[model samples]
Target: MTEALSLVPTTDARVARAIDLIWREADLLDRREYRAWDELYADDALYVIPIDRETDDFASVLNMVYDDTRMRRMRINRLTEGYAIAAVDAARTVRTVSRFVPLAVSDDEVTVRSAQILVAYKRDHHDLWAADVEHVVRLGADGDRIVRKVIRLVDSEAAVPAAGFLL
Candidate 1:
């Protein structure tokens, strides 16, 4: 049997606050609130999906995405545009978050890593699908407000089916 895991430790107040934000972010995504999801990013923020490979060389392999604010907006646009089939089936998925940890904490930034499990139920065409994923998020400063979020998804590239929707 598999043993249970624990969350990351944090003594910093910023880390605690950031963890809350991260949780809220995950909740928003699971709830399919893309508009709120878009609001969470810093203007110059980046959202990256590095392509999974057998090798450890990230720079050499292609990343599924490395989106800046504009690109992220485009992503939101495409999903809400109603032309994407995945989005049609998207509202049926639910993702659960756990084992959230603060890997690194700084005065102006925080990096968090968390475990996610998503279970999706589509119509009669597809059976239920599920996956376990890890996210590495980088939070940075944008003036008085905090901005910037970079997420790395750790999963088997081939195993992923229609993550057409951002994780």
Candidate 2:
């Protein structure tokens, strides 16, 4: 069995909280609520899509996308401010995240693994992007915030189409 699906889902309160946040994030993305999506992350969060499937040292390795706070802000700006390009040409994406596997859970934090199938529609074509997603959530007293998100696309080494929406 694959590591991601080896473990079963849990009913822990912390896990529920983390999964709720993740689902909310997914809803925000589908609704094109970029600002709300931005608020879901912590200040020290890392958003990464690595080309190397096995390496976790994203800082030292090459990545398709590695966004810190500043970079993420800039990218969001490009998409939300520049023009209606993102609205017009950007693919309409609807993503399903399931098969929850709690990697680590604690009172202060939770790291979960899940499967994400994102369907993007552009013009007359519909494309599917399947990935294994790992989310590290910091459970704060006020609310939980995403500390790190790593999306590993199944076709990372193949020629992938342009994604008009954020994964």
Candidate 3:
């Protein structure tokens, strides 16, 4: 889905800041830097991967993942402490997030919609996952924090191969 920019794309430098943070996130995930990745989110943040493509009510709908801070921390522990994402299905991945459309920009917040394409290689097989991702970032004196992230998978209804890495 192509989203026409709702605001001037280059007028505000906050948009650029948001993109830079997003790129940093993608890199941390690729490198399995779970600790650093965890710090990017706010205390009340949500990280969601919803099965419903058109739904904004993520809490009431069925989702592949709906993680609050506690849940996210648990997931990170599983991925880092043990072998949850490092075991049999361990895949080397490279992901690119682009096609940015700034939906909202303010002094204290920036909302962005973008496209992400990820490729994971495991056991001589390659898998592709594509999604439209939305991020709501909160600007702060300390640092910018992600307050919400919703990843809508392209083939949500189809059977996707199991992935060991975070999307």
Q: Which residue runs of candidate 1 sit more than 4 Å off their true CA positions? A: 1-8, 53-60, 124-154
Clashes of 2: 0
Task: Give candidate 3's root-mean-square deviation (CA, Å).
Answer: 3.4
Selected candidate, larger lDDT, 1 vs 2: 2
Clashes of each: 0, 0, 0
Better of 1 and 2 by TM-score: 2
- Worst 10-residue lDDT window for candidate 2 reads 1-10
lDDT of 3 at 34: 84
- Model 2: per-residue lDDT, tens digit, 1-167? 21342343557778899999999999999888888899999989999998887989999988889999888877787778857576546888899999888998777888899999999988899899999999999999888999899999998878888665788
lDDT of 3: 0.87
Among all candidates shown, the one with the greatest lDDT: 3
Please rank every candidate by lDDT, starting with the best: 3, 2, 1
Report the C-alpha lDDT of model 3 over 35-122, residue by residue, as the tens digit.
8999999999999998889998988988889999999999888877765646335788899999998987887888899999999898
Task: For each candidate in the order shown, give its overall lDDT on alpha carbons.
Answer: 0.59, 0.86, 0.87
Give TM-scores for every candidate, taking all chains together and pairing residue i with residue i. Answer: 0.72, 0.92, 0.92
